[model samples]
Target: LDPFVDWLQKRKIPRGLGIVIIYILLFAFVSLAVILIIPPISKEVTQISENFPLYYEKIVNGFNAFKSNLESPENTEQVQQGLNSLGENLSATVSNVAGAIFSIFGGLFSVLLVLVLTFYFTINEEATRGFIYTFAPSNIHPYINSLHTRIQKKLGSWLRGQLILSLVIFALTFIGLTILGVPYALVLAFIAGILEIIPTIGPLIAAIPAAFFAFLQSPVMGVSVIILYIIIQELENHLIVPKIMSKSVGLNPLIVIISVLIGAKIGGVFGALFAVPVVTAISVFLRDIIEKKVEAETKLVQ
Candidate 1:
């Protein structure tokens, strides 16, 4: 957005007018996407609701048969309890995910707040920086600005890269699911794309429903779905993440996994979504501080 505004400014456009133009373009793009996507998703959701009972019956029957075959009563009871616990946990997880999604997309107030803040910050970019600088010592103002700029660039790069990653996952998942003759490929792909934001655990969670639906058709189909997701995950971890996120975040995969887990534990889905950027910002500051300390130590030794 800033780059686009800068381009417009170079063309002798007023900054405020340029912002409005960018906002209009963004709104138009979002509108077009919603128009194109919503209908198919709605249909898929309706179909899922209509067919869910059949799927549930099949699962119950299968579980019952498995329980009947168990030789020991105690073992069967333990298994039942484990399954009941699993169901409860899964239910809670689904509820949490749905709530998070609704909070993010359904909350008009949140969206408007973000827009307003962004507009204010962008419009008063220099003034905002000056205001912030006023709180710090004048000698360290340059350092603070440099740190801010670094964090901003990293965050911007990360956001752009994440959007690209999600689109790529969506396309790949859609193509794979379609080729495999899975029902609700579009919906599943959309889930895959959206969940790609959560790093390590998201792909695994996205695969569950896909595999469940595929398993309803055939065991082979279920296995294939799982395999497809695994392949995609491998590709994402080995190829896509390295190429897309490495430059932007510059954190090891282990660190990212840890940060995401910590964030999710603390703040749920939205926290996981922002964990990488927040960590990146901290890393930038830490690096700067370490460098300054090392320089001071070297000067003292000299």
Candidate 2:
């Protein structure tokens, strides 16, 4: 045992272990950045898409009438009418832009805040890992270490893959909502993007806004949002999820549902946020133990 321990000390863990750890840290840093960065960006992007459209027609008519006056000076009545509309449109557009200038200014500060958070995670990854490692007992250090590696692998893959899935889901949702001429298409899309992070309940949470805002605007828009979410959710669950889940983490549908339900019930946004990662980590460890036991039994029989 001493000779084996001495050999372990002399030989050192493989350089590959260091590389993998670094890669995992980078992955976590970037994933956390997306969580931090995307929410604000989505808010700002949706705000631009939402509030701008509030005066979109005003902006459009302003430009159209201004152009008509320049192009066709022959008809005084048309030119005068165009000029009048242009003036009204311009007045409305100017006020809309001015009213939201404070929000635009505030947005810059939010961007900086996200950047600081992401950079902090990237640089101090080791400290964070150490903190997490302390949660497990010292007697089971090796077991906990193995579980830690497995959890990171599962989560990193899941998060990276989920990024693609969320974007696609958001894009599809946006197109459908926009086509239905939903009042706040961008806001719906942004909500869909964030909710898409959570496993089962996410899409439902996102759909509520689409339905509420749409129902307020028009019943048809409300129905459209519901149908759109259903189809998109189907596509995400059946096609995208199976295709993209790195290593096919093979979580039972029942387990996924239960985890999301319990998570949402317990901690609101945080529980939903962490539910899948916790489940995935547990699933990884269970699989590892099963595989190891089977191998040991097979070797003993031989």
Which number leads on lDDT?
A: 1
Residue-by-residue lDDT tens digits, candidate 1, 1-302 = 67788899999998889998999998899899899987898688667766665765676677789988989999988987887686566556544654665676654554566677778888888898899988988998888888878888777777788899999999999999999999999999999998887667889899999998999888999999999999999999899988887777556556778997898688666556667768888989998889989999999999
- Which regions in candidate 2 have their CA more than 4 angstroms from the true location? 1-149, 246-282, 297-302
Q: lDDT value for candidate 2?
A: 0.67
User: Could you estimate the TM-score for every candidate?
Assistant: 0.82, 0.48
lDDT tens per residue, model 2, 1-302: 11222344466744334444545776699789778756765565456545544554554555566666575555656766776686577557645754564664555554455445544543455575677668867777777766776676666666677788788887888888888888667666877986776667788888875785666565676787788889888888788787877464455656777897798699654565567778998788788889999999999999
Which residue runs does candidate 1 get wrong by more than 4 Å? 64-104, 251-280, 299-302
Location of the lowest summed lDDT over 10 successive residues in candidate 2? 1-10
Q: Give me the displacement of residue 37 in model 2, in angstroms.
A: 10
